[model samples]
Target: MSGGLIGLSGLIILFVLLIIRIPVAFAMFAVGFAGIWVLRDLNSAMSLLASESFTIASSAELVVVPLFILMGNVASVTGMSARLYDAAYAIVGQIRGGLALATVLGCAGFAALSGSSVASALTMGKVSMDQMNRFDYDNRLSTGVVAAGGTLGILIPPSTGFVIYAILTQQSIGRLFLAGILPGLLLLSMFMLTVVLLCWLMPGFGPRGPKSTMREKGRKMAGALPVLLVVILTIGGIYGGLFSPVEASAVGAGLVILIGVLEGRLGFARFWEAAKSSIVTSATVMLILISAHLINPFLALTHIPTLIGEYLSALDVAPMVVLGLILLTYLVLGCFLEGFAMLVLTMPIFFPVITQLGMDPIWFGVLVVLTLEMGLISPPVGVNVFVVKSVATDVPLGRIFAGVMPFWIAMLVTLAILVAFPQIALILPNTMIE
Candidate 1:
């Protein structure tokens, strides 16, 4: 039997394991180990495992992942989300569906610090939903905006997804990060625009309140200035080459702690909690990554990625058609899998095909991140949706899902734009690095 077919059988076993509710990391690892043993020998497989683990563990770039995650955990536990939301509300709260708009904006701002979508959604929903409900905003609209907006966590800088993609594809983490900035802001704009449009069309969807005086607006802006500065200093330093991503994360974490202490918001208890959470989260990510390395070499031995790339390249297909299909597949797979697991599993198979077809890796990363956003809000296992439901249990899951539909449409529209004009995701990275 051919090596590829032997590898193909491993894939089948992996899927069966997944369907039986095996953890994704261990399932992939087991299948990969078995595949290597079958194709070569147990000794070679054991050597590969030993060597790959050391290499992945020793990489300098990998430090950025845990550091950034630690920064996020610190910012989250220090009550940064509430402060950002208050600042957002002060700016937009008086407008039609203002609180909803604020929720989206707040999520985007919070996302700058927190790289996890589930964390962002959970934090923002807990802090923002009651205010939205108080404003008499539609349940679906409020829930939808927050859930969709939480996805920006990865779309913006310091994302675990971007780090993983860079590592997997051997791309520069800094460039991958720069590539996402404009697209992230662009999506943020589109999200805000969608809220406005919805309010304009269906006035009852979001009710307008008394406009704030200039003085009040100024105070709100000032209240949020510290966070804005943190974002600018950390993200700005990384993009501007003043600090490496890892150093930038350290700076960010320090700044968050400083701000929290100055404001008397981050006591020892909160700091300890954040530290413990960061350690646990970092351990989990490292485990998944180790598992990915195991599966990756096995998949490479199959040369299936090459075969898939050749098949895709040979097809009489428009790149956009293929792009759409890939996205639709993500949308479907999203219903069952969380974003991180899905990316780790599929990128090995799909990214090569897309890259060989002359697609930009940076653009593809944004597209993948955007597509993963849907998975966060999609039914069954939508991480963000489940988060919102957990916080607002009185609200039905159906209503939260229903509310998120418009935002989902907004996300789809943004995806179409990125696909149509690859420049949207590429221009910043290209020029910035030059």
Candidate 2:
């Protein structure tokens, strides 16, 4: 068999492994190592595996992953996320569908620090679900909004999704991060609008929440101010060229830890728990990245990316048409694969086609990350939906999925808008300070 076909078979086997409930990192690692051994030699495979693991583990820029994760964990444990949610609820809870809007806003706020849909969903779900239920909101909308809103974590800055895309594509992490901001805010706005439309069409989906006086609202807002400042400073510092992405992540994580500790919100036990969670999450990401490095080289040895890119290049269709198809593939894959797995597996093939088509890597990265966000709430394997379900145990899985449908459509709309006007993502990246 040709090396390409052998590579193809290895990929199929990898998916089969994944289907059998093997961990993604292990599945990729096993397939990639075996592919190298078969296509090259055992010595070459061993060398690549060892070198790649060390490279991934030792890379300084990758420190952003653990630091950002630490930020999220600290925020979750210290009640910073709860305060953010309470602030949004105070500001928006009184209007029809206001609680849902607050949920989206809260999710957005937490996304800035957390950079994780699961964390965002878990934190926001715990904070907002009971309040929505108390307001007699529909279970579907309440859970759905949390699931959908949590997806903002991947679209916003400090996003692990953006970080992964940057590392895979060799794009600038800061520029990729900048690229996500406008698009993220746009998606956040669209989600809020979706809630408005739903409430207008069916008032029962999200009932009006109790009103908050200005004094009460001020208190909630005041409570969130410290953490909010951390978001502003970390993101702004990145934007203004004051800090590298890794440095920004460190500053953000440090600020959260300091703020939490000083306020007695993160006591010794909680602090240790947050740090442990961050380490575990970071280790998992490092493993996935290392496996990706191994698999990418094996695929290179097979010339599969070249084979596919050449075929796509010879096509007569406009590049945008091809881009649309690539995104459509992502949308379909969203129902099955986790975002990181899809990114690490497909970027070697698709990103080459992208550059060959004369597309901006930063623009494509934003688009790809946005597509990953959609997967977080897509059914059957909507990771964020399931995360929400874990916290909202009384809400049916089907109901959570149903609730997220409108927001999913909103994501589609946002993607379409960005595709039509690439500037939405590129403007900030293009104008970046450094």
Model 2 segments more than 4 A misplaced: none
Q: What TM-score does model 1 achieve against the real structure?
A: 0.94
Which predicted model would earn the best lDDT? 2
TM-score of each predicted structure versus truth: 0.94, 0.98
Each prediction's whole-model lDDT (CA)? 0.84, 0.91
The reply for model 1, stretches above 4 Å from the true place, is none
Q: Which residue pairs collide, candidate 1?
A: 140-403
Instruction: Work out how many backbone clashes candidate 1 has.
Output: 1
